[model samples]
Target: MLALLPLVILAATPIVLLLTISTERRHALTAGLALTGLVGALLALPTAAAQAPRDVTVLLRVDASGLAYAALAIVAAACLVVIGYRYVGAREANPEEYYVLLLIATAGIVAMAFSTHFVSFYLGLEILSVSLYGLMAYFRRDRWGTEAGMKYLVLASASAAFLLFGMALIYAELGTMTFAGLVAASPEQMSNAVVLLGLAMLCASIGFKLSIVPFHYWTPDIYDGAPASVVAFASTAGKLGVFAVIVRYFLLPVGAVTSGLTTYLVVTAVASMLVGNLLALLQTNLKRLLAYSSIAHMGYIAVAFLAHGPVAAETVTFYVLGYTLASIAVFGVIAVLSTEPGRTSDLDHIADYKGLLRTRPVLGAVLIAGLLSFAGIPLTAGFLGKVYVVLAGAQDGHWFVLLALALSSVAGAWYYLRVVVAVCSTPDGESALERPSVPAAPTAVLAVLAVAVLILGTYPAPVLAVIESLHR
Candidate 1:
């Protein structure tokens, strides 16, 4: 079971390469690669569950947590492939290179999930980050793409430096870089000063990756500048990978060093939630709104993290999985709808959606489902996810955090409902009521996502059971 991990990862390479070979072959290659990766990942799941937790080396470990996150990444990647099929082919960019980068990024995310040591974690992060830089700037001729790439590179490089320095401090104090070793060496061999400083740096570094409050300056610009498909990848898969590592780190018992970290995290979480939602209310562009929305969503996940217990871990994992699925679904709709050649995701403007129900009822319905899920409406996966997170927070006696969450939810409703209202509004122009054509592949993708959202919401037991079994 353990032996199949590397094999599954390697299997994705050939098809990813095929995506770049020629225009005529791009769609088939991308679809094949996505399907192959999904199957390989799913096949590995039972084995991963059956096998005892194994240490591949000091740097890599395969545990239930890692397996869960890897599975989520693979699923999200598969959805993105379907969402991107039409957009990639229509653009002037090389479809093959785009898919190759995506596969490499997926591999990096999986690697990150299984990493047991700082060295492996950094390696996985760098691989994912570098590929994303190119993916962000894939439309090189476009100013938005180029600017977004540059901003991402500079900010990401700075964060990487901080992360390396923090790792060095940790290693110097403990003489080991592995998480297990660090936990074991604490108290007697490690001091509060070293641990606190190291953790602070680590928080700052990861904050950049997760787009948390102070380090979130780059997210909106990048999301607005990049194509919708790339933004989708960054928002869902990239964030989940970082959260997987963050959960592992926080779950470790580091004694007094971690004593007040929960309070600090709770404060940041509330701040992010308030700030992200409030700022989003003012944004006219769809990409920027979603970017801010992503920040707010991360804050909710952080609330679960601050709860700091077995239930917290379970809640966080479930929330991340549900949120990732919903984001992919929402972005898939955006990708198909925002397919105009020169435009970015700005095409998802509220006004652009006016009379969408009249024009494209099926697409409009799918969009409504996705938006309602994001808004945490009843009978949607997002609502269940929020309930779990809020319950975890309340369990931890985080009344203020719970209050902040409630307020943010109320504020969030305005923007999401605005879109729905636009979709149902009367069309003023002739083209406004004209149905937008979505190909069979994208239509099928939307259908699958819509079904998954409903299923996860109505009968969340199966997935929740799987999450419950994933204890460290």
Candidate 2:
């Protein structure tokens, strides 16, 4: 029971929130309650950590990786709550329910992060996916939002079907559905044609979440239509939870799955890097740009999977946490700047931010910092992540894929800089954006994220040491 404290706290938050909403519909009350539960869940991590490396059940395991992923997911939700506070509060819609759905989705993320069985994985994915369908279309008046939500629902359902069929096939052949049981299979069992087909289907589903090439069709529309806060969580914690599961099942023992699957992973990684970056260059909407950029970032991290042992774990975990920090700041800036209270539409287009530096210096600086991080500039969180991914790839002698990563990153830098240059450009007369009054909630979150980015970039040893200790 003690080992389940974190999950228990996280999973219970939405229920408490639902009950509270029935009594009181105040936005502050719901948001405050959500934050309380999320923070409590985060605090409970150490308690769960004390029981680390234990199987809480056949479906779940308590381990260093799970704890770290849970921490990041919880923090990501907390940050989203803060970022969305003003955005949701000013809306006429029932703002209280939004926090409830957010928490439910977060619980699902935590569940998926700790899952060991296919059943648990599917359950968590459904929970997360179902909640997001509602979130993606929360604003009923927005046609684009409704369309995006419907698209997500359809595609996500198809992916779920694929996942279930894959699980059935794998189980039929191996007589087990647990990740451990599958990975522990003999070469002969894994090499079966039926097993390979199932693995291909599974990869397709995972790629959907990671927003990689071919499976990434839904990303731009969702990012383009969803509220900034929702996009923030989906892009970071949502994808991160799935990637956590990937690292667990796929990366642990390099050759444990099959060399064929490894080649498949490598091909997708390279394709995502090249395809994602090339597409990002064509996007003029800030959120859509981020969508493509995220695909590329996932590719970079995927390369980290080439390294085995604790090094692989450390690189992925730290990179994820760091990327989350930078992402929060970037999306938080969008949340603050894009919409005025009571407004239905956001200033999401690139042209809307002309002369942003001169108009809103604080927000501009924060945006520039985040953009630089995306470009993997030195003295930023992204640099550490990029360096480690390169090192990991080099260590494993994946030099060809490493070249793809390097080239794509260079292409990524161009688009990221374009945004930076726009922000810094002076607006002559009419181009200056009106500096709307910003709220304290998102500002505080961005400030915290900014400091975290700087700290992790310049002085990573302390945090890296902690992650290393956990695995040791």
TM-score result, candidate 2: 0.96
Worst 10 residues of 1 by lDDT: 1-10
lDDT of 1 by residue, 72-122 (tens): 887787778877877876664556677778877887888888887899899
**What's the CA error at residue 324 for candidate 1, in Å?**
0.6
What does candidate 2's lDDT look like per residue over 1-472, in tens digits? 8888988987888899899888878888889999999999999999988988889779988788788888998999998898888877665468788888888898898889888999999999999999998887887776777887898898788789889889999999999999888978888899899998888888888887778787888888888888787888888888767867876775455456567766876898899999889999998998889989998988888788777667777888888888888898898888787557657766688877778888887788888888888899999989998999999888869999999998999999999999999999986587636756787767777877887888888999999998777555
Clashing residue pairs, backbone N/CA/C < 3 A, model 1: 19-96, 20-96
Model 2's number of clashes is 0
In candidate 2, how many Å is residue 97 off? Answer: 0.4
Minimum summed lDDT over a 10-residue window in model 2 is located at 250-259
In order, what lDDT does every prediction score?
Answer: 0.79, 0.84
Which candidate achieves the best lDDT against the true structure?
Answer: 2
Q: What is the lDDT of residue 283 in candidate 1?
A: 83
TM-score, candidate 1, is 0.92
Error of 2 at 189 (Å): 0.4
